[model samples]
Target: MKKITSALVALGLGVALSASVQATSNDEAVAERIKAVGSVCIEGDDTCGGAAAAPAAASGPRSGADVYTAKCASCHAVGVAGAPKFGTSEWTDRAGKGMETLLANAINGINAMPPKGLCADCSDEELQASIQHMIDSAQ
Candidate 1:
Protein backbone atom coordinates (compact mmCIF):
# COMPACT_ATOMS: atom_id res chain seq x y z
CA MET A 1 0.00 0.00 0.00
CA LYS A 2 2.83 2.45 0.75
CA LYS A 3 4.53 1.69 -2.56
CA ILE A 4 1.22 2.09 -4.44
CA THR A 5 0.66 5.53 -2.77
CA SER A 6 4.17 6.70 -3.80
CA ALA A 7 3.60 5.59 -7.39
CA LEU A 8 0.25 7.45 -7.56
CA VAL A 9 1.86 10.67 -6.25
CA ALA A 10 4.72 10.40 -8.75
CA LEU A 11 2.29 9.86 -11.62
CA GLY A 12 0.24 12.93 -10.57
CA LEU A 13 3.43 15.07 -10.48
CA GLY A 14 4.46 13.90 -13.95
CA VAL A 15 1.02 14.69 -15.35
CA ALA A 16 1.15 18.19 -13.78
CA LEU A 17 4.65 18.78 -15.20
CA SER A 18 3.57 17.68 -18.65
CA ALA A 19 0.55 20.05 -18.58
CA SER A 20 2.78 22.95 -17.44
CA VAL A 21 5.23 22.27 -20.25
CA GLN A 22 2.40 22.23 -22.87
CA ALA A 23 0.99 25.52 -21.52
CA THR A 24 4.43 27.13 -21.64
CA SER A 25 4.97 26.01 -25.24
CA ASN A 26 1.55 27.38 -26.26
CA ASP A 27 2.44 30.75 -24.64
CA GLU A 28 5.80 30.77 -26.44
CA ALA A 29 4.15 30.05 -29.78
CA VAL A 30 1.68 32.89 -29.26
CA ALA A 31 4.54 35.25 -28.33
CA GLU A 32 6.48 34.22 -31.43
CA ARG A 33 3.44 34.86 -33.66
CA ILE A 34 2.89 38.31 -32.12
CA LYS A 35 6.55 39.20 -32.67
CA ALA A 36 6.35 38.09 -36.29
CA VAL A 37 3.06 39.93 -37.11
CA GLY A 38 3.26 43.17 -35.09
CA SER A 39 5.13 46.19 -36.42
CA VAL A 40 5.48 49.99 -35.87
CA CYS A 41 5.36 51.84 -39.20
CA ILE A 42 6.86 55.31 -38.85
CA GLU A 43 7.93 58.02 -41.36
CA GLY A 44 9.59 55.65 -43.84
CA ASP A 45 6.68 53.17 -43.95
CA ASP A 46 3.75 52.67 -46.42
CA THR A 47 1.86 55.93 -45.59
CA CYS A 48 4.97 57.76 -46.82
CA GLY A 49 4.75 60.82 -44.55
CA GLY A 50 1.31 62.13 -45.63
CA ALA A 51 0.48 63.72 -49.01
CA ALA A 52 3.02 66.10 -50.64
CA ALA A 53 2.13 69.79 -50.25
CA ALA A 54 0.94 71.84 -53.20
CA PRO A 55 3.35 74.31 -54.86
CA ALA A 56 3.07 78.05 -54.20
CA ALA A 57 1.01 80.40 -56.40
CA ALA A 58 2.64 82.32 -59.25
CA SER A 59 4.32 85.71 -58.54
CA GLY A 60 1.46 87.60 -60.25
CA PRO A 61 -1.95 86.59 -61.57
CA ARG A 62 -2.17 85.30 -65.14
CA SER A 63 -3.37 87.78 -67.78
CA GLY A 64 -7.01 88.00 -68.95
CA ALA A 65 -5.96 87.60 -72.61
CA ASP A 66 -3.99 84.47 -71.77
CA VAL A 67 -6.88 82.95 -69.83
CA TYR A 68 -9.36 83.71 -72.66
CA THR A 69 -7.22 82.46 -75.55
CA ALA A 70 -6.58 79.19 -73.77
CA LYS A 71 -10.06 78.44 -72.37
CA CYS A 72 -12.84 80.74 -73.64
CA ALA A 73 -11.98 80.54 -77.35
CA SER A 74 -12.83 76.85 -77.38
CA CYS A 75 -16.57 77.61 -77.00
CA HIS A 76 -16.97 81.35 -77.51
CA ALA A 77 -15.02 81.73 -80.77
CA VAL A 78 -17.18 79.21 -82.68
CA GLY A 79 -20.45 80.01 -80.82
CA VAL A 80 -20.69 76.46 -79.58
CA ALA A 81 -24.11 75.85 -77.98
CA GLY A 82 -25.28 79.31 -79.13
CA ALA A 83 -22.46 80.99 -77.20
CA PRO A 84 -22.07 84.40 -78.79
CA LYS A 85 -19.22 84.51 -81.31
CA PHE A 86 -16.25 86.44 -79.94
CA GLY A 87 -16.30 90.20 -80.83
CA THR A 88 -19.89 89.98 -82.20
CA SER A 89 -22.94 92.15 -81.51
CA GLU A 90 -24.37 89.02 -79.86
CA TRP A 91 -22.06 89.79 -76.95
CA THR A 92 -23.47 93.35 -76.79
CA ASP A 93 -26.69 92.16 -75.13
CA ARG A 94 -24.71 90.19 -72.55
CA ALA A 95 -22.32 93.12 -72.07
CA GLY A 96 -25.38 95.33 -71.49
CA LYS A 97 -26.03 93.16 -68.41
CA GLY A 98 -22.79 94.66 -66.89
CA MET A 99 -19.38 93.24 -65.90
CA GLU A 100 -20.38 91.95 -62.46
CA THR A 101 -23.27 89.97 -63.97
CA LEU A 102 -21.01 88.65 -66.71
CA LEU A 103 -18.40 87.50 -64.20
CA ALA A 104 -21.04 85.73 -62.13
CA ASN A 105 -22.50 84.03 -65.17
CA ALA A 106 -19.06 82.92 -66.35
CA ILE A 107 -18.13 81.53 -62.96
CA ASN A 108 -21.50 79.89 -62.23
CA GLY A 109 -22.78 79.41 -65.81
CA ILE A 110 -26.00 80.55 -67.53
CA ASN A 111 -28.21 79.44 -70.42
CA ALA A 112 -26.09 77.11 -72.59
CA MET A 113 -22.81 78.21 -70.96
CA PRO A 114 -21.19 75.85 -68.45
CA PRO A 115 -19.55 76.99 -65.22
CA LYS A 116 -16.28 78.67 -66.12
CA GLY A 117 -17.34 77.42 -69.58
CA LEU A 118 -16.10 73.99 -68.42
CA CYS A 119 -12.88 75.34 -66.91
CA ALA A 120 -13.77 73.66 -63.62
CA ASP A 121 -10.58 74.48 -61.69
CA CYS A 122 -10.67 78.17 -62.62
CA SER A 123 -10.88 80.52 -59.65
CA ASP A 124 -13.74 83.08 -59.41
CA GLU A 125 -11.19 85.83 -60.09
CA GLU A 126 -9.78 83.87 -63.04
CA LEU A 127 -13.30 83.60 -64.50
CA GLN A 128 -13.62 87.37 -63.99
CA ALA A 129 -10.45 87.94 -66.01
CA SER A 130 -11.78 85.59 -68.68
CA ILE A 131 -15.02 87.60 -68.92
CA GLN A 132 -12.94 90.76 -69.25
CA HIS A 133 -11.12 89.25 -72.22
CA MET A 134 -14.41 88.49 -74.03
CA ILE A 135 -15.74 91.94 -73.12
CA ASP A 136 -12.51 93.55 -74.26
CA SER A 137 -12.64 91.68 -77.56
CA ALA A 138 -16.18 92.94 -78.18
CA GLN A 139 -15.03 96.56 -77.84
Candidate 2:
Protein backbone atom coordinates (compact mmCIF):
# COMPACT_ATOMS: atom_id res chain seq x y z
CA MET A 1 0.00 0.00 0.00
CA LYS A 2 2.82 2.43 0.83
CA LYS A 3 4.63 1.81 -2.49
CA ILE A 4 1.40 2.25 -4.42
CA THR A 5 0.73 5.61 -2.77
CA SER A 6 4.26 6.86 -3.56
CA ALA A 7 3.87 5.90 -7.23
CA LEU A 8 0.58 7.78 -7.44
CA VAL A 9 2.20 10.91 -5.92
CA ALA A 10 5.10 10.80 -8.48
CA LEU A 11 2.66 10.42 -11.35
CA GLY A 12 0.66 13.44 -10.21
CA LEU A 13 3.85 15.56 -9.94
CA GLY A 14 4.93 14.52 -13.45
CA VAL A 15 1.54 15.52 -14.93
CA ALA A 16 1.61 18.98 -13.25
CA LEU A 17 5.17 19.64 -14.49
CA SER A 18 4.23 18.60 -18.01
CA ALA A 19 1.22 20.95 -17.99
CA SER A 20 3.32 23.88 -16.74
CA VAL A 21 5.88 23.36 -19.47
CA GLN A 22 3.21 23.13 -22.15
CA ALA A 23 1.59 26.36 -20.92
CA THR A 24 4.90 28.19 -21.07
CA SER A 25 5.54 26.96 -24.62
CA ASN A 26 2.08 28.09 -25.68
CA ASP A 27 2.59 31.58 -24.15
CA GLU A 28 5.88 32.00 -25.99
CA ALA A 29 4.35 30.93 -29.29
CA VAL A 30 1.49 33.40 -28.92
CA ALA A 31 3.90 36.24 -28.15
CA GLU A 32 6.01 35.38 -31.16
CA ARG A 33 2.98 35.33 -33.44
CA ILE A 34 1.81 38.77 -32.26
CA LYS A 35 5.19 40.55 -32.58
CA ALA A 36 5.32 43.69 -34.76
CA VAL A 37 6.04 42.87 -38.40
CA GLY A 38 7.30 46.24 -39.54
CA SER A 39 9.46 49.14 -38.31
CA VAL A 40 9.55 52.90 -38.90
CA CYS A 41 12.35 54.26 -41.08
CA ILE A 42 13.87 57.60 -40.18
CA GLU A 43 14.39 59.96 -43.10
CA GLY A 44 17.88 59.70 -44.69
CA ASP A 45 18.34 56.17 -43.49
CA ASP A 46 19.69 53.95 -46.26
CA THR A 47 18.29 50.68 -45.00
CA CYS A 48 14.60 51.54 -45.16
CA GLY A 49 12.26 49.66 -47.48
CA GLY A 50 12.36 50.62 -51.16
CA ALA A 51 9.04 52.49 -51.20
CA ALA A 52 9.81 54.32 -47.97
CA ALA A 53 12.09 56.86 -49.64
CA ALA A 54 11.17 60.51 -49.15
CA PRO A 55 8.91 61.75 -51.94
CA ALA A 56 10.78 63.58 -54.68
CA ALA A 57 9.90 67.26 -55.02
CA ALA A 58 7.74 67.88 -58.05
CA SER A 59 9.49 69.07 -61.23
CA GLY A 60 8.94 72.56 -59.84
CA PRO A 61 7.54 74.17 -56.75
CA ARG A 62 3.82 73.54 -56.56
CA SER A 63 1.67 76.33 -57.97
CA GLY A 64 0.38 78.91 -55.48
CA ALA A 65 -3.17 78.01 -56.41
CA ASP A 66 -2.48 74.38 -55.66
CA VAL A 67 -0.80 75.15 -52.38
CA TYR A 68 -3.53 77.57 -51.38
CA THR A 69 -6.28 75.12 -52.25
CA ALA A 70 -4.57 72.29 -50.42
CA LYS A 71 -3.36 74.12 -47.34
CA CYS A 72 -4.97 77.56 -46.90
CA ALA A 73 -8.41 77.35 -48.47
CA SER A 74 -10.07 75.83 -45.44
CA CYS A 75 -9.31 78.86 -43.32
CA HIS A 76 -8.85 81.68 -45.83
CA ALA A 77 -11.73 80.73 -48.10
CA VAL A 78 -14.42 81.58 -45.57
CA GLY A 79 -12.46 83.83 -43.19
CA VAL A 80 -12.56 81.21 -40.52
CA ALA A 81 -11.03 82.49 -37.27
CA GLY A 82 -10.59 85.96 -38.79
CA ALA A 83 -8.49 84.69 -41.66
CA PRO A 84 -8.59 87.13 -44.57
CA LYS A 85 -10.99 86.00 -47.26
CA PHE A 86 -9.64 85.59 -50.76
CA GLY A 87 -11.02 87.67 -53.67
CA THR A 88 -12.35 90.36 -51.33
CA SER A 89 -11.45 93.57 -49.46
CA GLU A 90 -10.87 91.65 -46.28
CA TRP A 91 -7.18 91.45 -47.24
CA THR A 92 -6.71 95.10 -48.12
CA ASP A 93 -5.33 96.08 -44.73
CA ARG A 94 -3.10 93.01 -44.64
CA ALA A 95 -1.93 93.73 -48.17
CA GLY A 96 -1.27 97.32 -47.08
CA LYS A 97 1.35 95.87 -44.77
CA GLY A 98 3.41 95.06 -47.89
CA MET A 99 4.31 91.71 -49.35
CA GLU A 100 7.37 91.40 -47.13
CA THR A 101 5.39 91.77 -43.96
CA LEU A 102 2.63 89.54 -45.28
CA LEU A 103 5.12 86.84 -46.17
CA ALA A 104 6.80 87.15 -42.81
CA ASN A 105 3.47 86.99 -40.98
CA ALA A 106 2.37 83.99 -42.97
CA ILE A 107 5.66 82.23 -42.46
CA ASN A 108 6.02 83.02 -38.76
CA GLY A 109 2.32 82.98 -37.90
CA ILE A 110 0.36 85.92 -36.44
CA ASN A 111 -2.75 86.14 -34.30
CA ALA A 112 -4.80 82.96 -34.77
CA MET A 113 -2.77 81.75 -37.76
CA PRO A 114 -0.22 78.97 -37.40
CA PRO A 115 3.33 79.15 -38.69
CA LYS A 116 3.49 78.51 -42.44
CA GLY A 117 -0.30 78.66 -42.18
CA LEU A 118 -0.25 75.11 -40.79
CA CYS A 119 1.62 73.88 -43.85
CA ALA A 120 4.64 72.63 -42.02
CA ASP A 121 6.06 70.80 -45.03
CA CYS A 122 5.78 73.81 -47.37
CA SER A 123 9.09 75.26 -48.52
CA ASP A 124 9.77 78.97 -48.02
CA GLU A 125 9.33 79.50 -51.74
CA GLU A 126 6.08 77.58 -51.65
CA LEU A 127 4.83 79.66 -48.73
CA GLN A 128 5.75 82.85 -50.57
CA ALA A 129 3.92 81.69 -53.65
CA SER A 130 0.88 80.74 -51.61
CA ILE A 131 0.81 84.17 -49.99
CA GLN A 132 1.11 85.76 -53.41
CA HIS A 133 -1.76 83.62 -54.60
CA MET A 134 -3.92 84.93 -51.78
CA ILE A 135 -2.92 88.52 -52.50
CA ASP A 136 -3.64 88.12 -56.18
CA SER A 137 -7.00 86.55 -55.52
CA ALA A 138 -7.97 89.28 -53.06
CA GLN A 139 -7.06 92.04 -55.49
Candidate 3:
Protein backbone atom coordinates (compact mmCIF):
# COMPACT_ATOMS: atom_id res chain seq x y z
CA MET A 1 0.00 0.00 0.00
CA LYS A 2 2.88 2.38 0.69
CA LYS A 3 4.49 1.68 -2.68
CA ILE A 4 1.15 2.13 -4.49
CA THR A 5 0.60 5.51 -2.85
CA SER A 6 4.08 6.73 -3.86
CA ALA A 7 3.54 5.70 -7.51
CA LEU A 8 0.20 7.51 -7.70
CA VAL A 9 1.66 10.72 -6.30
CA ALA A 10 4.52 10.64 -8.80
CA LEU A 11 2.16 10.05 -11.70
CA GLY A 12 -0.07 12.95 -10.61
CA LEU A 13 2.94 15.25 -10.31
CA GLY A 14 4.18 14.24 -13.78
CA VAL A 15 0.78 14.94 -15.31
CA ALA A 16 0.63 18.42 -13.72
CA LEU A 17 4.12 19.31 -14.97
CA SER A 18 3.26 18.18 -18.50
CA ALA A 19 0.08 20.26 -18.45
CA SER A 20 2.04 23.34 -17.27
CA VAL A 21 4.57 23.00 -20.06
CA GLN A 22 1.81 22.54 -22.69
CA ALA A 23 -0.05 25.61 -21.40
CA THR A 24 3.08 27.75 -21.72
CA SER A 25 3.68 26.53 -25.26
CA ASN A 26 0.08 27.20 -26.22
CA ASP A 27 0.23 30.70 -24.74
CA GLU A 28 3.38 31.44 -26.73
CA ALA A 29 1.74 30.24 -29.96
CA VAL A 30 -1.25 32.47 -29.33
CA ALA A 31 0.96 35.45 -28.63
CA GLU A 32 2.93 34.89 -31.82
CA ARG A 33 -0.24 34.70 -33.90
CA ILE A 34 -1.60 37.94 -32.40
CA LYS A 35 1.66 39.90 -32.78
CA ALA A 36 1.81 42.97 -35.07
CA VAL A 37 2.95 42.28 -38.66
CA GLY A 38 4.41 45.74 -39.28
CA SER A 39 4.94 49.16 -37.65
CA VAL A 40 5.38 52.65 -39.09
CA CYS A 41 8.05 55.00 -37.72
CA ILE A 42 7.93 58.71 -38.48
CA GLU A 43 11.23 60.43 -39.16
CA GLY A 44 12.90 61.84 -35.99
CA ASP A 45 10.16 60.31 -33.82
CA ASP A 46 12.87 58.46 -31.80
CA THR A 47 10.21 56.45 -29.98
CA CYS A 48 10.31 53.64 -32.53
CA GLY A 49 12.69 51.77 -30.14
CA GLY A 50 15.53 50.63 -32.41
CA ALA A 51 17.73 52.53 -34.91
CA ALA A 52 15.96 54.72 -37.50
CA ALA A 53 15.30 53.27 -40.94
CA ALA A 54 17.55 54.63 -43.69
CA PRO A 55 15.99 56.93 -46.27
CA ALA A 56 15.51 55.58 -49.80
CA ALA A 57 18.43 56.38 -52.12
CA ALA A 58 17.94 59.10 -54.74
CA SER A 59 19.01 58.22 -58.34
CA GLY A 60 18.50 61.81 -59.53
CA PRO A 61 15.96 62.98 -62.12
CA ARG A 62 15.33 60.54 -65.01
CA SER A 63 16.33 61.48 -68.55
CA GLY A 64 13.69 62.59 -71.10
CA ALA A 65 13.89 59.37 -73.12
CA ASP A 66 13.70 57.29 -69.96
CA VAL A 67 10.63 59.11 -68.67
CA TYR A 68 8.95 59.03 -72.07
CA THR A 69 9.62 55.33 -72.50
CA ALA A 70 8.24 54.42 -69.09
CA LYS A 71 5.29 56.83 -68.95
CA CYS A 72 4.45 58.47 -72.31
CA ALA A 73 5.01 55.52 -74.66
CA SER A 74 1.65 53.93 -73.89
CA CYS A 75 -0.49 56.65 -75.51
CA HIS A 76 2.07 58.69 -77.47
CA ALA A 77 3.61 55.74 -79.29
CA VAL A 78 0.58 55.18 -81.46
CA GLY A 79 -1.39 58.38 -80.80
CA VAL A 80 -4.10 56.62 -78.84
CA ALA A 81 -7.06 58.91 -78.01
CA GLY A 82 -5.69 61.76 -80.16
CA ALA A 83 -2.26 61.80 -78.47
CA PRO A 84 0.42 63.16 -80.75
CA LYS A 85 2.29 60.22 -82.26
CA PHE A 86 6.04 60.05 -81.78
CA GLY A 87 8.26 60.61 -84.86
CA THR A 88 5.51 62.42 -86.81
CA SER A 89 4.64 65.90 -88.10
CA GLU A 90 2.01 66.05 -85.37
CA TRP A 91 4.70 66.90 -82.80
CA THR A 92 6.15 69.50 -85.17
CA ASP A 93 2.71 71.11 -85.54
CA ARG A 94 2.25 71.11 -81.76
CA ALA A 95 5.72 72.60 -81.32
CA GLY A 96 4.41 75.78 -82.93
CA LYS A 97 2.53 76.39 -79.65
CA GLY A 98 5.89 77.33 -77.99
CA MET A 99 7.45 75.78 -74.89
CA GLU A 100 5.37 77.72 -72.35
CA THR A 101 1.98 76.83 -73.81
CA LEU A 102 3.07 73.23 -74.41
CA LEU A 103 4.45 72.90 -70.91
CA ALA A 104 1.17 74.22 -69.42
CA ASN A 105 -0.86 71.86 -71.58
CA ALA A 106 1.34 68.97 -70.58
CA ILE A 107 1.14 69.97 -66.92
CA ASN A 108 -2.61 70.36 -67.13
CA GLY A 109 -4.60 67.69 -68.89
CA ILE A 110 -5.22 68.60 -72.52
CA ASN A 111 -8.18 66.87 -74.16
CA ALA A 112 -7.54 63.12 -73.82
CA MET A 113 -4.02 63.52 -72.39
CA PRO A 114 -3.89 63.42 -68.63
CA PRO A 115 -1.77 65.85 -66.60
CA LYS A 116 1.91 64.90 -66.92
CA GLY A 117 0.94 62.41 -69.64
CA LEU A 118 0.77 59.50 -67.25
CA CYS A 119 3.98 60.64 -65.48
CA ALA A 120 2.63 61.72 -62.13
CA ASP A 121 6.16 61.79 -60.68
CA CYS A 122 7.84 63.72 -63.51
CA SER A 123 9.15 67.20 -62.65
CA ASP A 124 8.58 70.22 -64.97
CA GLU A 125 12.16 70.03 -66.24
CA GLU A 126 11.80 66.33 -66.97
CA LEU A 127 8.56 67.01 -68.82
CA GLN A 128 10.27 69.65 -70.96
CA ALA A 129 13.06 67.22 -71.70
CA SER A 130 10.55 64.57 -72.79
CA ILE A 131 8.80 67.16 -74.99
CA GLN A 132 12.12 68.03 -76.60
CA HIS A 133 12.86 64.36 -77.15
CA MET A 134 9.59 63.84 -79.03
CA ILE A 135 10.07 67.03 -81.01
CA ASP A 136 13.57 65.93 -81.92
CA SER A 137 12.21 62.57 -83.04
CA ALA A 138 10.07 64.39 -85.62
CA GLN A 139 13.25 65.41 -87.43
Candidate 4:
Protein backbone atom coordinates (compact mmCIF):
# COMPACT_ATOMS: atom_id res chain seq x y z
CA MET A 1 0.00 0.00 0.00
CA LYS A 2 2.86 2.43 0.82
CA LYS A 3 4.54 1.66 -2.53
CA ILE A 4 1.26 2.21 -4.40
CA THR A 5 0.78 5.61 -2.69
CA SER A 6 4.32 6.67 -3.56
CA ALA A 7 3.84 5.63 -7.19
CA LEU A 8 0.57 7.53 -7.43
CA VAL A 9 2.21 10.67 -5.93
CA ALA A 10 5.15 10.40 -8.35
CA LEU A 11 2.81 9.97 -11.32
CA GLY A 12 0.78 13.04 -10.25
CA LEU A 13 3.94 15.14 -9.89
CA GLY A 14 5.18 13.97 -13.31
CA VAL A 15 1.87 14.92 -14.95
CA ALA A 16 1.91 18.36 -13.29
CA LEU A 17 5.53 19.03 -14.35
CA SER A 18 4.72 17.91 -17.91
CA ALA A 19 1.76 20.27 -18.06
CA SER A 20 3.83 23.23 -16.78
CA VAL A 21 6.61 22.45 -19.26
CA GLN A 22 4.11 22.36 -22.12
CA ALA A 23 2.53 25.65 -20.97
CA THR A 24 5.95 27.35 -20.87
CA SER A 25 5.88 27.74 -24.67
CA ASN A 26 5.13 31.44 -25.37
CA ASP A 27 3.93 30.77 -28.90
CA GLU A 28 0.87 32.31 -30.52
CA ALA A 29 -0.09 28.73 -31.46
CA VAL A 30 -1.36 28.08 -27.91
CA ALA A 31 -3.41 31.29 -27.97
CA GLU A 32 -4.83 30.34 -31.36
CA ARG A 33 -5.94 27.01 -29.92
CA ILE A 34 -8.03 28.89 -27.30
CA LYS A 35 -10.81 31.05 -28.71
CA ALA A 36 -12.40 33.95 -26.80
CA VAL A 37 -15.77 32.59 -25.80
CA GLY A 38 -17.32 35.87 -24.63
CA SER A 39 -16.89 39.61 -24.12
CA VAL A 40 -18.07 42.50 -21.92
CA CYS A 41 -20.47 45.26 -23.07
CA ILE A 42 -20.38 48.91 -22.02
CA GLU A 43 -23.30 51.22 -21.17
CA GLY A 44 -25.70 52.34 -23.98
CA ASP A 45 -25.44 48.84 -25.44
CA ASP A 46 -28.88 47.48 -26.27
CA THR A 47 -28.35 44.40 -24.07
CA CYS A 48 -27.48 46.34 -20.86
CA GLY A 49 -30.83 48.19 -20.67
CA GLY A 50 -28.90 51.49 -20.25
CA ALA A 51 -28.87 50.91 -16.48
CA ALA A 52 -25.10 51.37 -16.22
CA ALA A 53 -25.33 54.75 -17.87
CA ALA A 54 -27.99 55.70 -15.28
CA PRO A 55 -25.65 55.45 -12.26
CA ALA A 56 -22.85 57.54 -13.81
CA ALA A 57 -25.54 60.13 -14.39
CA ALA A 58 -26.93 59.47 -10.90
CA SER A 59 -25.49 62.93 -10.01
CA GLY A 60 -25.63 63.12 -6.23
CA PRO A 61 -28.74 62.45 -4.12
CA ARG A 62 -31.99 63.80 -5.42
CA SER A 63 -33.96 66.42 -3.49
CA GLY A 64 -36.73 65.24 -1.14
CA ALA A 65 -39.42 66.24 -3.61
CA ASP A 66 -37.50 64.57 -6.41
CA VAL A 67 -37.04 61.33 -4.49
CA TYR A 68 -40.67 61.49 -3.50
CA THR A 69 -41.73 61.83 -7.11
CA ALA A 70 -39.43 59.10 -8.36
CA LYS A 71 -39.94 56.55 -5.57
CA CYS A 72 -42.44 57.47 -2.83
CA ALA A 73 -45.05 59.09 -5.06
CA SER A 74 -46.26 55.71 -6.21
CA CYS A 75 -48.01 55.02 -2.87
CA HIS A 76 -47.74 58.15 -0.74
CA ALA A 77 -49.07 60.54 -3.32
CA VAL A 78 -52.35 58.69 -3.64
CA GLY A 79 -52.38 56.66 -0.41
CA VAL A 80 -52.44 53.39 -2.34
CA ALA A 81 -52.37 50.30 -0.14
CA GLY A 82 -53.19 52.55 2.84
CA ALA A 83 -49.97 54.57 2.57
CA PRO A 84 -51.64 57.76 3.82
CA LYS A 85 -51.89 60.37 1.07
CA PHE A 86 -49.42 63.21 1.28
CA GLY A 87 -50.70 66.53 2.69
CA THR A 88 -54.04 65.11 3.73
CA SER A 89 -55.82 64.92 7.07
CA GLU A 90 -54.56 61.36 7.46
CA TRP A 91 -51.03 62.60 6.91
CA THR A 92 -51.51 65.32 9.55
CA ASP A 93 -52.66 62.72 12.05
CA ARG A 94 -49.60 60.66 11.25
CA ALA A 95 -47.39 63.71 11.70
CA GLY A 96 -49.02 64.23 15.08
CA LYS A 97 -47.53 60.84 15.95
CA GLY A 98 -44.29 62.85 16.44
CA MET A 99 -41.42 63.59 14.05
CA GLU A 100 -39.05 61.11 15.64
CA THR A 101 -41.66 58.39 15.42
CA LEU A 102 -42.38 59.26 11.81
CA LEU A 103 -38.68 59.36 10.93
CA ALA A 104 -38.14 55.93 12.53
CA ASN A 105 -41.17 54.51 10.83
CA ALA A 106 -40.13 55.89 7.46
CA ILE A 107 -36.53 54.70 7.73
CA ASN A 108 -37.24 51.32 9.36
CA GLY A 109 -40.76 50.88 7.95
CA ILE A 110 -44.20 50.73 9.47
CA ASN A 111 -47.19 48.50 8.73
CA ALA A 112 -47.71 48.43 4.91
CA MET A 113 -45.07 51.13 4.50
CA PRO A 114 -42.03 48.91 3.80
CA PRO A 115 -38.64 50.14 5.05
CA LYS A 116 -37.39 53.24 3.23
CA GLY A 117 -40.34 52.76 0.89
CA LEU A 118 -38.40 49.79 -0.50
CA CYS A 119 -35.59 52.14 -1.61
CA ALA A 120 -32.79 50.27 0.17
CA ASP A 121 -30.23 52.56 -1.51
CA CYS A 122 -31.72 55.69 -0.06
CA SER A 123 -29.47 57.25 2.62
CA ASP A 124 -30.80 58.11 6.08
CA GLU A 125 -30.27 61.79 5.35
CA GLU A 126 -32.29 61.46 2.17
CA LEU A 127 -35.07 59.66 4.05
CA GLN A 128 -35.05 62.40 6.67
CA ALA A 129 -35.26 65.02 3.97
CA SER A 130 -38.21 63.27 2.40
CA ILE A 131 -39.89 63.00 5.79
CA GLN A 132 -39.26 66.66 6.46
CA HIS A 133 -40.61 67.48 3.02
CA MET A 134 -43.77 65.56 3.83
CA ILE A 135 -44.13 67.32 7.20
CA ASP A 136 -43.47 70.72 5.71
CA SER A 137 -46.03 70.18 2.97
CA ALA A 138 -48.59 68.90 5.44
CA GLN A 139 -48.22 71.96 7.63
Separately for all candidates shown, the number of backbone clashes (residues 3 or more apart, or on different chains) is 0, 0, 0, 0
lDDT of 2 by residue, 1-139 (tens): 9999999999999999999999999999999999899887887888885665768656778989999999999999999999999888777777899988888888999999999999998998998898888888866
Model 2: lDDT equals 0.89
Candidate 2: Cα lDDT at 72: 98
Better candidate number, 1 or 3, judged by lDDT: 3
Q: Top lDDT: which candidate number?
A: 3
Q: Give lDDT per model, in order.
A: 0.80, 0.89, 0.90, 0.80
Candidate 1 Cα RMSD after full superposition onto the native fold (Å): 9.2
Give me the runs in candidate 4 sitting further than 4 Å from their true place.
1-59
Question: Which candidate number has the best TM-score?
Answer: 3
What C-alpha lDDT, on a 0 to 100 scale, does residue 110 get in candidate 2? 95
Candidate 1 per-residue lDDT, tens place, 14-127, comes to: 999999999999999999887855444465555643343323556466677777888889988989989988888777778899988888888778989887888876777777
Q: Model 2 RMSD to the real structure?
A: 7.8
Model 4 misses residue 63 by how many Å? 1.2
lDDT by residue (tens digit), candidate 4, 75-123: 9888889987888777688878887888899888888999999888898
lDDT of 1 at 28: 97
